[model samples]
Target: MKGQGKRSICVSLVALTFASALAACSSNSSSGTQNGTAGTAAGTTADASKEHRTLTVEVFDRGKPGQPDLNNNFWTKYINDNFGKQFNATVNFVSVPRAQEVDKLNVLMASGQAPDISFTYTQGVVYNYVQQGGLAELDSVLKQYGPTLTKYLGDDVLKYGKFNGKQFSIPGKRTVLAGSNTFIRKDWLDKLGLPVPTTPEQFYDTMVAFKEKNPGNVSGVIPYGFSLQPSNPGLNYIPEAFKPSSLTEEQFATLQPQSIWLTNWNMPGFDKAVQYMNKMYNAGLISPNFATDKDGKLLDADISNGKVGAFQTNWDGPYRTAPGTYANLAKNVPGAQLIPIDPWQNDAGKHPKNVYSPNGMYIIIPKTSKNVDLAIQYLNWMADPKVTLFLQNGQEGVDYNMVNDVPKQTGTTNSGDKMMTVANNLDYDILSNGIELGDQQKNTAAISAGYPGYEKDVENALKVGMVDSYTTYYYSLPNAADAKSNTELKNLSAQMLAKLIVAKPAEVDSLYKTLVQQYMSQGGQAVQDEYIKNYKAQNGK
Candidate 1:
């Protein structure tokens, strides 16, 4: 719940771009991240060394671990020395926590202390700030200072950040994929002599059997672990299990009996999945406290210890701990492997399409800033691939080295400054950032180093996966009301389904009917209509 749309509560910020006329007056700033470094002498037309102005930036790594030191962060320092040396200006930096970012930004905007360049994510804050005229338009800036930027920001990338046909925000260089599929512990499946589960029913049976058997020096397993609690999007993974083949293209599609009004609870697969869950609960397969607890304690601690058999997670592996969940598990448990169970991975009846989302993370220029051009110039400098690589890894000889043109780390360095002391580093933000679809191959080495084919496996799964049905329609409702209503609807549906799982087969039908009525009353129909309208509008059909 906390990870879902809750960030919107603190997302009301001010934004607007300054007039285009000022862009011509602004000169390029030195690439130097510090106060007085010069930029590169020999560079492209947009080179910072040829221009002069101070650029301010806002990045998210204020107190976080594994970041650049304020003084030695390669990019910052490079800009300070190299860029400043060439252009005679320096870069100013601001840092904030990821969770409270929106709120902090809002406060800054209200206090009239907005930064020149700021990072704005979706969840209402960016749009709120833009609507309030607190952010700047970057069309002129991009045209004048960023011809390379113009080339990379293709049409698809430009569509999402547009509001009413005018572009207010530029998509960052990073692209984010949709939700994950069900990840099963392969070792448990092999121990139970079970094959990879292709259907929800088969998946349910495996979880049940795993709980019943209690193999591998562990007691009974927690069948089907999840982090879905109050108002969390993690529960979104559930509906996929019971999705009707006909509505596979549209999980939130209308079921064609508005007169009868069959809700999601009554859908063909809906009741069955819930009934299975209830059975698991009553039989002690599922933890009884699952409904009340959502911190993922049951999944993270219990499953990580090899006590739980199966859980829903992203393709990358245990989302709670990066690389640790998958890496450590494989290292500790013999034959431990992550298996992705697709709700529709093998369903030939449906054309698979993963969910597509607009860019949540963006770099923007606040309207209140004194030096808009300087900020844009700094961002432009950061966008360079060479700069990106430098930020991510470190200096060439110190942090990392190119062996046959492939970047390899010489030694581990936690801070960018420290890394820079040794070798050149990769700037993930600069190298792999994008608002649209990105080439996984570009970041292949880094992602693999950390996740080990996790990205590719997930993408392959998504090729046959189902995207969330609500993403497109979500924007129509008032921001607050939309988030709250969806959360409540999903929670009620989960609750009802959980109950039906335990009820007698005879009692299942009636329970499902009751759920249908409740769903309709909760504006499920209106929600469906919104999706249909938006989908058509997007396709121009």
Candidate 2:
């Protein structure tokens, strides 16, 4: 009833805005629909009038098996049937490979051929385009066509889209901000007569015990699961816990966190973290081939096989059904009690970690598009609470059933109405990610109800992950040094950290010193200096 009320209001707003826009149109130039194809350049001025135009939106193609094509799925058709029909536009979806999205997007952007609606996780790439005058300024367009979008995203999330006092993008809202949540085998703890670890030291002891005792009774039991993906090392899982308690805001801001600071090698006590990791490596308490576990799928296998004792990942890592870590573990090792826990405490006795900044992908309309108005409208349509609920949960009693207030997923075997296997078809819900049911209680309840057998565990994982989480420093302005060298610096950091983690315990301090010097020499100092300078200018601190 609450969602329904909100939905009616939003739907009215959408219709009213569309009517007003359609009434004031100057022309109607028609372009036929292009389904799931690459975007071509289109005029931004006269064609933006009231036109039956082909609006090409970009979507990720993971090439997953059994899933519908990204272009012609039930969801895509639903989008066209609803939003596309309303605007008299043919909505075409362009597929960008998920693994090489940035590279593919770059190729498309450089030739002025990006999709009408495109987005990326990296702000630096967007910033580069902004500096080059390659993006459209959406402030006036958004105000005229995207009133509901403005209210839905609000200033908080909208700020990420703004560049040089102009709204250049719409940042997708992230419901849960927590970055990394750690999961441990409760059954193993029960067998070993050990408590859930509460401190870093205790966690280390627990890992040592896990290694020695083999509490799971599995051969090659990895006490800690880790990954060294060059692009996404994921700091919150490891070195960030060693972040000094006395870390100043200035120091934190200078850490170059947007992309390259993935490993957190720049943190004050980073060497100590590496040393601790080295200790884990020597004791054989960590994954033996972590350096090779790029993309984290290998770590997932270890987790599913019940070989991992404890691991850290995105808040809902183990819960998702595909590559279903929790579900697989349940079937493979019966009584496998994997539960979320917060054990790795920082120096301040806080489980401090970098949470998301209430935003996921940076949604942008490239300057090459004539469909800025349509683009804004399409996003607003998705932002409508009704559209959001239907997209996420699907039709009641068909794909899901309402138990209390939340929609719990049921059998979705009906091919015509089946939901995308990807947790919530997140790729299509371009304006938002993670479930947001208007309130925190409903959100938690919905998450609990969705994953039937591991309902409570997933709920606790989310709550625990959020306990001491905080968003990383966000600069309204882009850093040039970051744009230029983030890829190089991140790769370097991942490689250096991986090596340091495998180095002998005694060699850690000196090796870390050498790596820091090398890192600083190779544009790291420039990034830090520029960051600190900008920090002071912005904060006046």
Candidate 3:
């Protein structure tokens, strides 16, 4: 908290002047009370408020089947502790697994048992909730109590939470990176007397060198591999060298004249990328069953077997593989270390074309809440830097310790592990921005020690990050008919890329042209027109 107060004061003075704003109001309560007889449901109540009320919240829980803690974990307890004190209303934790979260909440919405706050994902769900008239527009409420959020979440992102100009949900911001950085076995690189790659050609050479020199050791290793599932694409691990398909390019094209990039995924670079992979595949440099295996099994088998020489992977790596998964690997292969190979190392700042996904997750406010203002008050508190830090780092000595002027966690707690505990114990959630503002170092130290460094690296990487040219709102349209079409186009493009990569080199252009035609036919042109019009309208073009 060294320069915290100063930073806040400077920020406020130049901007909202939070102190004056708060001082303009009386020390009147920001609390919510239960219904004893009738209710002071909205934010109009004066001081001298008292009652026992509970606000139900719906959330995703990471727990085994039939576990009570899944729904009401330790983290939920901690969150309620703070909210209950501030609001005088209990915050209830409603749990559902990831797969069932939206579906279950939909059911709850239909039954009128929907919690006061629910986190969701797709724009479809958020828009659906809004269309149902089941959400509150927090314009007034946020104006009164959300200065911190107003500052941090910014305007456009906040507007993204709106439906037809009215804010219906809170923006659940989530951090994004182009693709998981490619990690190579550095030890092998040293043994082969080769420098780290700094271009696509160099990277291919390095992989080829490793395969040639190491022989059987790297025979089954994948030089360039990733989870290629239709559902997700393990989006975070896409190579920056593939920068042609970036969101920035898309946005630029919306305004200026530029060739359609991602639409035509069969470009020379893509074909070349595939050709490199083909070499890996035929030379036995990649895992034999890569295409057939699911994401988890593919990673688990490759990393554990010490056969993955280089791969597109998240910095956190595969530490969370199920029980006995990583442990089994440790027993079988001791020297199989995962070394971070910055994609820049391979392509040397040559980013591959890709788009930024939206920067947030989903948030829903139930229509049943007694005091929407009170709820907003508490959530605004979540936007407070102090509170964000606490939620991320935990309460001082209890969750972490300060060392060398850095906040670090202590004991058997890690960020992800602690997140599970904290979510259940404290009723907390994740946000996209402010990863560094919170005691992030402390949180990461306990778990992967790699977290802090990775955070910084990713932050640095964003300087060149391409914001998606398309608005997530396009994905939230009335029937989401536009999004469905884009999805089809994207899928067709990916399939063509895959086929081109796996096919004979000569067949690349023909297949790419076919995919491009498929894109135009699948409402790609409509999507482009809509995206261009909307983008200009939003940006005042």
Candidate 4:
């Protein structure tokens, strides 16, 4: 299976001039009918004028247990009114659970019920579909119908969509590229006369002090709050400090998980990290129910109730914004102060974090779709700057007001919750050219409007330069072993890590070794071998 050779083939192409190609193509005409013939163009116009084609789009549904309908909300009607009427197309959105996107799309594709446009963050899912010929080749389709999208995404970014010399999908561009960082309660530190930690030992000591002193209303305070859930595990970045630099070419290629390459539990420093976590658990410094708080609700509540002293979260959400952990905590516990800090120093004594890929989601057309051109047209329309603004901020006067040329959201509801009511348009905003990238002054003003006087905190948090995780290259090639074994390996790793953190101090080392060996034997070795082979071939090493 090592020399199956499916992974060895590479595609290299000179940048095709999009403007000339687009200028030559007939306007609003689908792929094959681009030539201006009276019969073809007239016939297409007549058909479109009489009856509009139906386009089904897959969007992420993130409603709570008993909230309003996520799919059929105000944004659905907005899309129908604005896009459908303009394009002579009827728009329908299919809701896929955000957490179970891969599983649900697999079922839909298998049953020939997949939408015209489907998207995923996982590279393997798209690879699997392309390998099975389940995706539509978008190069010709895009050239004929997607001038706006081509112009917006450009040639360099679109290269990410190419596989085996064909464009199988459109790669969404990411506006930001920094991993999550640790945040601590500055008020607590001040109350206890403690300074912010800069090293691993200092961080450990701080947690111990927080546990012992109980700075703010000491009773029931958790020094460190974390969750072991697969999706958003707590303290996920702690082990990076212990990561070993010396690695073989193969080891480096397969070192970290897909979309994450800066650090890994399989590396040398993981044992020490786990042991430190175990020590915290034993000393009651970490939350007691961390192993079972899979969805992070408990931790969220703890942070809000002023029970958590420190936690790790994405740069923007938890620290610098409102309707978030910091905002909620401030409302519940007066004078709560949260500050972002890059305190994890690796073996090299430097703060290193994973660099986010510029690619956000892989948007694809299904082979079974009847209206591929219409789908491409819809995406192109969305890539328009005005449309992107409207989708992101809603009606200017109603949902937001322009301040310093930035659309700052208005009303009592904060930006985070307001997004849900607006059909979470950001998810369906396939182009991802939101206000975050458009205007710096407006972006800062909008963030400040959300969480008054915290714009500087958000700005400071973005100052840390991130290191590349190399996920772009990893996602380009197919890894057969990963398709077969990555899920199991991740599950095993999460479970074992939890066990290692809560086990007896003496049992920690043995537990780590046993789990690592088990992980390798179960399928990690095969996955690593395939990645190593692909990396060497791609890099000509």
Q: Evaluate all candidate structures by whole-model CA lDDT and list the values in order.
A: 0.52, 0.73, 0.50, 0.67
Query: lDDT of candidate 3?
Result: 0.50
- lDDT tens string, model 2, 379-459? 877777777877776667767788888887776723342446457667888777778777888988887776777788778
Tell me which of candidates 3 and 4 scores higher on TM-score.
4
List candidate 1 segments past 4 Å from native.
Answer: 1-52, 65-73, 83-88, 175-178, 208-217, 231-238, 244-276, 279-284, 319-323, 326-337, 343-360, 403-406, 419-439, 451-480, 483-509, 512-541
List model 4 lDDT by residue over 98-204, tens digit each.
86887787777766677788897766677777777778899988888787788777876787787766899898876556656678999999998998998878888
lDDT of 3 at 428: 60
After superposing candidate 2 on the true structure, give the runs of residues whose Cα lies further than 4 Å from its correct spot. Answer: 1-56, 61-81, 84-115, 218-221, 234-236, 256-261, 292-307, 410-421, 536-541
Best-performing candidate as measured by TM-score = 2
Model 2 local distance difference test score: 0.73
* True-vs-predicted CA distance for residue 378, candidate 1, Å: 3.1
Residue-pair clashes per prediction, in order, are 61, 0, 44, 0
Q: After superposing candidate 3, which stretches have Cα over 4 Å from the reference?
A: 1-46, 50-52, 65-81, 175-179, 215-222, 233-285, 318-336, 343-349, 352-358, 385-400, 404-427, 430-479, 482-495, 519-530
Estimate the overall C-alpha local distance difference test score of candidate 4.
Answer: 0.67
Q: Backbone clash tally for model 3?
A: 44
